[model samples]
Target: MICRSCNQEHNNNFCPNCGEKRDVEKITLTSMMSYAFASVTNMDKGFLLNLKMLLLKPQRITSEYLNGKRKGILNPISFLILSVTLYLVVLELFKIPKKPSDISKLPSGTLETLGNMSYKAGQFIRTYLKFFWILAIIPLGLAQKLIFRKYNFTEHLAISSFIIGQATLVGIISYLILRWPLIFDPVIYIMITWMVYRVFRTNNKLDSLLLAFVVLFLFILQLILITFLIGLSQV
Candidate 1:
């Protein structure tokens, strides 16, 4: 059989050249519906199992994923996306708290400009919160890729995704128990500290812990950078 994708001749269930299925199914209403349903509702991607393994051994997931382990685990970006979705659902269901005060009401002057920027930044953090959470991963990944130089930028992104995904889950739990969701910060940082240590896994415990603190600083710096950019764009 000639592979339709790469045109390599092979008689097998899948094309060895590109791994495309040998017999492509015709697009029918039933098949389309099934595909859509699976894409949306497929827990067989192993959300719970992946979450467990992610907590236990995040670094392993990053390495194994790059090594082409694609079965029974959620990809890093997908995990982050799913975590965001779950976080949003919990936020809606629980109605966590009031958002930051309206940015429109800041008093006029340089003070007002600064205040407006600050207010808008707070609003940005809360509104479209999921997108902000995802963007936070970018700076972190870039920082790790540059600083560690152990893995390439893409690998660092996978690590960052897992870190943020786990953060979102921790935030959900904090949101449930805490009256003020602002408390979510300390909890998330603690969890990420552990993740960072595990990812780097140095023999020097002190260095790893300090480096984990650096990870927290990096995230905070990214948040401020994003806010600055957003503020400037509106100005």
Candidate 2:
């Protein structure tokens, strides 16, 4: 049979050159719906597999992905995006009110200016929270690079993405428990620390302790940077 994808001759169910299916059926509504449903099912399976591997064997999953065993598992960036999107949807579905930080200590003039500016400027920032998330990934990657000097930057990035995705899921659960804006921050930090330690398991207790401290330091640094950005925007 002639392969349509690469114009190469093949006699299999799929094109060996490009892996496109050879069973070219007529276009119909039923076919389209079936194809869409199949795609969704495959994606759902991939995501579930990724989640299970991340929870059960994070190091193995990262190593496998870095080593080019890529098929049948969700990619890190896609996973992160999906997780955050789902989290945002959950927040909206529950009508979770935004809990602003306490600014009572600031001067009345500053408060007034902030209240005025925040409504306009804050909307832009809130709408692009994903950008802030990507920005934080850089520093988080750097922290991982410092701790695991042998790994390349891209490897650190992939792992960090997966970690952030998992942390988002954990944050949703944490929110349900306390329903406080900042309450999930500590939980996320702990989740990150545990995830990283699982990925880079060490024998020495001191190494584990240091990783715990490093995760806390990174979380604190992220918090400070975000606070500074928000404060600057208020000005």
Which structure among the candidates has the greatest TM-score?
2
Q: What are the per-model C-alpha RMSD values against the true structure?
A: 3.9, 3.8
Checking candidate 1 for backbone clashes, the offending pairs are: none
lDDT of 1: 0.77
> How does each model score on lDDT?
0.77, 0.74
What is the Å distance of residue 17 in model 2 from its true position?
A: 2.4
TM-score of each: 0.76, 0.80
Clashes of 2: 0
Query: What lDDT tens digits, residue by residue, belong to model 1 across residues 1-235?
Result: 8999999999999998899999998999999999766655665555665677677877777678778887877778888899888888887898845655665677788978888777666666677677877877888887676557888888788889988888778878887786445324677767877888887877898887787778677767876778888866656
Report RMSD for candidate 2: 3.8
What is candidate 2's TM-score against the reference?
0.80
- How well is each residue in 165-228 modelled by candidate 2, as lDDT tens digits? 8877787787677664422357877888888888777788678768857865875686566655
